[model samples]
Target: MIDINFGSLFTVELLHSYYKDQLCPDFNILPSNQTVKTLGGHQIIARQYSNQLITGVNCNGKINPPKPFTAIETGAQFTFFMQLNNPLFFNYTNLSSATPGKIYYFTNRNNNVSNGKTFLSSKIAVYNAANTYAPGDLVSNGTGITYRAIGSSKPGNTFNLTNANHWMVVDKNQYLTEADALKWMPSISAYQFASPQASVNISVLGYDNIATTYTQSVFSKTIAFANPASSFPLDLSFLQSGKYSLTVNGIQQWIYINDELSDSKTFAVIDIFNDASPVSCNLIDGSGALINPAPHYSIYFLNRATIWKYILASKQSGNINDTANLYHFANPASVITSLTPIPLSNKALNLKLTLNNHDYSPIACADPQRLVTITKGTDTYPCSEIFLNF
Candidate 1:
C-alpha cells in the first residue's frame, strides 16, 4: 500500500468593486450557507490572495467531479487559482458543464507529467519551489501578483518581490478595465512606418596627471553614427588659454588649452646677465615665449643681496630719480654675456634681473603674478623693485 497526498494550494482574491473602475474590496466570497461577517458596519472582504481562509475555501479538495469551490456574492470581480494533484481527475472538455457562470480558468501542470517528462510552459507563469526562473521569465507570487525576473535566481523571499529593483510588476497595474485600456487604440485605414533611427556610443574622459587618475568629466551621450569621424559641438567659451589641473571623477589629470600652458615642463625662465644695467634681463614664459606688455607696463625690483628682498610695484618716467635711496651699482657690468647667472644675490656672479617698463628697466623688480623666480647654483632669489632708466 502507498500513501498518496491529494492536497494542492489555491488562491482567491477580490480584485474590483461594483463600479469596475474602483478597487475596493466591499464584496465577500463565502462557503455554502455561510453568513457574512460584520465589522464596523462597512463590509470588508479578502482583497489579497494571501488571505488563507478565502483561498482554502476556494480549494474543493481531491474529490472526483470536483465540487464548485466558493461563490462570490454582491457585485465584484474576483480571480482565483487552484492546483489539482494526486488521485484527482479533471477534464478540460466538460469544464463549462461542471462550473456555471462566466469562469476564467487555467490548469496547474507543475505536478502533472507526460511521457516521463514535465511540461514547460510560459503562458501561465506560476512561481514554485521546484522551478528555476531565468531573467525575463514571468512568475506569479501566489498573491495574484505577477513579477518578471531581473536575473536568474530561485524565488525564495516573497517580501522582496514587491520591490521594483528585484522584480518588475506586471499584473499589479491592472487598474483600468478592458474597455478603458482599448480606448487608446488608433484607428488607421492605411499606414507606413519610417526608417528606424541609428544609435552611436560615445565616451568622455577627465584625467589628472599629478594624482594619476582618470574620470569622466562630461556625460557621454548617444548620437547618430556616421562613416567618417565626427566631433561633438561643445562650447568651452568660459575657459581662457592656460594650463589647468583639475580632478574629474576623483581622478587627477593635466588639462592644456591654447598652448601647453598647463604642462609640467612649462615654466618662466628669467635670465639675469652681467650687463651695463644690472636690471637688464630676459623674461620668457615656460614655452620660451617672450612676455611683453600690451602698452603700459610697470615692475617691482627686490635686492636679494641684502636682507631687504621684498619688492614694491613702481613705474618708470623720463628719469631714474623717481624714488630716493635706490640701490645704485657703481660698477655696472654692461656686456657681461655668455655667463651663467647665480641665484645668490651676495655672490659676485649672481645676476638678478630687475622689473621695468622702459628699456632702462627697474632694478630688483619681482612680479608675483608671473611667478618669476631667479635660480642659481644651489640657491634662489626673490626680489623687490625701484624705478630706473637703461
Candidate 2:
C-alpha cells in the first residue's frame, strides 16, 4: 500500500473544492493504484479509493497529507503539535520598528526665494481698474481679499469674482483671525528615529515675501523620548494655514499647513506564519506583555511551493485565543508572525514569541510524530499522524 499526500500538490481549499465538484459520483468502482510522476520530478502513487483520490509516497507510516485538513465551519478550532530539533531560545528580534525619517509638505501658495529659504510673496498689489492685467498677476481688493488674473484683460475688464473670464479667487482673506488660527493647526504627521536621543530640537521658520533676508521663527521646542519603544504625536494646532519650513535636528523640509487637512497618522505591520501547528500564537513585546489584539490568522499562499495555490480566510482574529496566524513554508522552515496597525513612530518596539514546546529543551528523536486535532461544532477530526523533523 502507498500513501499519497495531496497537500504537496494542492491547498486544502482547492482539494475540498475539487473533491466536492470533480470527483466521480459513482462509488461502485474497485480501488486501483498507479505510480505517477509530477512535473516537479516527485513521483507519487495515486489511488482511486472511496469517493476521493489519494496520492502520496509513504514516508515511514505517517499520513500523506501532513497538514491539517479543512475545517467544517468558520469557527472551527485547530490544535496541532510541534517539536523543535534544537532547544528553543528567545532569539526573535523586532526588525519592523520605526526608524528616524523625515516628511515634506508643499502647497500652491505663491513663494519667493531668498538665501536658501522660501518666503510668502508680498508682490500682490491692490486691483487697479485703469491697469492692464496679465495672467498670473496677483491683485487684492481693498478688503484684504486676493485674486489672480487667469487671463489677459484690458483696463475695461474688472478683476473680481464676478469677472470669471479674467480673475480667480486665491485667498478670500490674507489675514487669519484668532478663530482661524485655532481652527487650522499644521503638524508633522509622523517621523522616526534611528536610535533614542537625549534631546531633539524642532524648529518651524516663517518668511515674508517682501524680499526679507531674515528668518521669522514661528515655533521652536525640544522634546525627549523616555522610551525608545514609544511614539510621539507632534501637534501644530497653533499654526495658521500657511507655508513654513520645518527643521528636526539638522534635517529641514517645507510644509504647507491647511486647516485640519494637514493632520495625519502613520502605521506599519509585521506578518508571522506558523508552519508547525494550527494553534493560535501570541506576540510578546519587549516588556513581556502579550500584544493586545494579537496577530490573527488569514489565508495566504504566495509562498507555497506546490502546484495548487488558493487563498483561504481564517476567522478575522483566528480562534478565541487569536492564534490562527497563517502557515507558510520558509527557507529555514519556521513560522512567521505579524503585528499590525502599529504607530509609525513606535517602530523601535522589540517583539518575540516562542514555538509551542513547553520546555525549551531540545528534542532527541528524529521524525517525531506530532498530533493535530481540529474541532468544529460537535465533530472532532484528528489529523493524520505527521512525522516532522523539527
Candidate 3:
C-alpha cells in the first residue's frame, strides 16, 4: 500500500483512478467555500433585548468572522446551540432559577457598525512630531475631540489648536481646544470595545381563521453559542394560510403567507386529487366567505339540537315566525326541557336543515311539539314555546 497526499492539488478523477478496480469508484470532497450555514461550524452570537435579568450568556464555541473578515466587517448570520451546561442559563427566577425550555430566533437589527462608526472620505496631510499616530488612523482626542488622519502625522500638541490641516476632527466640540489638549493621555474613556451577546430568544405562534382561536399557543426557545453545538431547524407549516407572529427576543413581527387564489375569494379547492370528482368540496359560510372545513363542521354538530327545535315549532302551528329568532348555528350542548311527538297530519311538511343556511347532519326532526334548551358553557338558550296560528 502507498500513501498519497493530495495537498489541495486534487480532483475527483484523480481519486477515482486509485479505486478504479473497486465497485463504486466515484468519490469527491466538498468544496470549502460552500454558502450553506451548518451547525458544525463557528458563528457570531449577539444578545436580544428583553426585560429579564439574564446577566449574560457564555458559549464555549468560536465565532467565524464575516466573509471578507476584517477589523471593520462583521458577520451577518449567527450560528448557535441549545445545550444543557454549555449555554449555562442564569435567569432571576425563584423556581429552578431560569425557565428551562425557552425559544428564540436570530435577527439582523443589532448588526451595528463597530462603535457605530462610519467610514468617511479622508484628505491628504503631512507627518507630525508633537503628536504620534499611524496611517489610516481615526482617533478621538477626548469626549468629542475625534480625528481621522489621511496620512501619518504628529503636528505637536498645539497643531490641532491652531487648526492644523494635517489632522481632521470628525466633530469639533464647543470645548475643542480643551479636548485636544489631552489627545494622547491615558484616559479611560478613549478605549472603546464591544463584544456581541452570547444568546438570543425566539417565539413562534400560529393561528387559523375559521377556528377563531390560535392553532397552537406561542412557543419560545433560546439559542446559545456553546460547546458541543446543539443546533436544530424549526418547522412552522401548521399555520397554513392564516397569519402568524414571530418574535426574536423582544422584537415582534407578523407574517402572512398568501395561499389563496388571486382570482377568487369565496371558493377554495381544498383537497383536489389530480382533477377528479368526489374530493372535499370548497368550504364556505352563509356569506360565501371561504372557511376551514374542520371548524365549519364543528359548528354544524354543535348546533344540531337547536335546528330540531326550530322545525318542530314551525310545523305544529303553521307559524313560520315561531322559529324566526332561532339562529342557524345552534349549540349542541343545549338541554331539552321537553320533547313531545306531535301527531302527523296532512298539514305537516318536511323541512331540510340546509334551507335554513345550516350544514347537513344525520339528525332529523319530524315532530312539531319538541321543546329543547341548549346550554353552552355558562350561557343557556331556552326554547319553551307553544305555537298557535291566529
Top model by TM-score, which number?
Answer: 2
Which candidate do you rate higher for TM-score, 1 or 3? Answer: 3
Model 2 agreement with the true structure over 270-299: per-residue lDDT tens digits: 112221122222222233222333332211
List model 1 lDDT by residue over 220-266, tens digit each.
54556454233333333344322233332233334323222122221
Local accuracy of candidate 3 as per-residue lDDT tens digits, 170-207? 34211111111101111111111133435556686764
Judge candidate 3 against the unseen true structure and give its global Cα lDDT, from 0 to 1. Answer: 0.26
Kindly report which residue stretches of model 2 are placed more than 4 angstroms away from their true locations once superposed. Answer: 1-190, 209-214, 260-390
Q: What is the C-alpha RMSD of each candidate to the true structure, in Å?
A: 40.4, 33.3, 35.5
Report lDDT (Cα) of residue 380, candidate 3: 40
Compared with the true structure, model 2 gives a TM-score of 0.21
The candidate, 1 or 2, that scores higher on lDDT is 2
Candidate 1 stretches greater than 4 Å from native: 1-123, 155-160, 172-390
Candidate 3 displacement at residue 348 in angstroms: 7.0
What's the alpha carbon RMSD for model 1? 40.4
- Say which candidate scores most in lDDT: 2
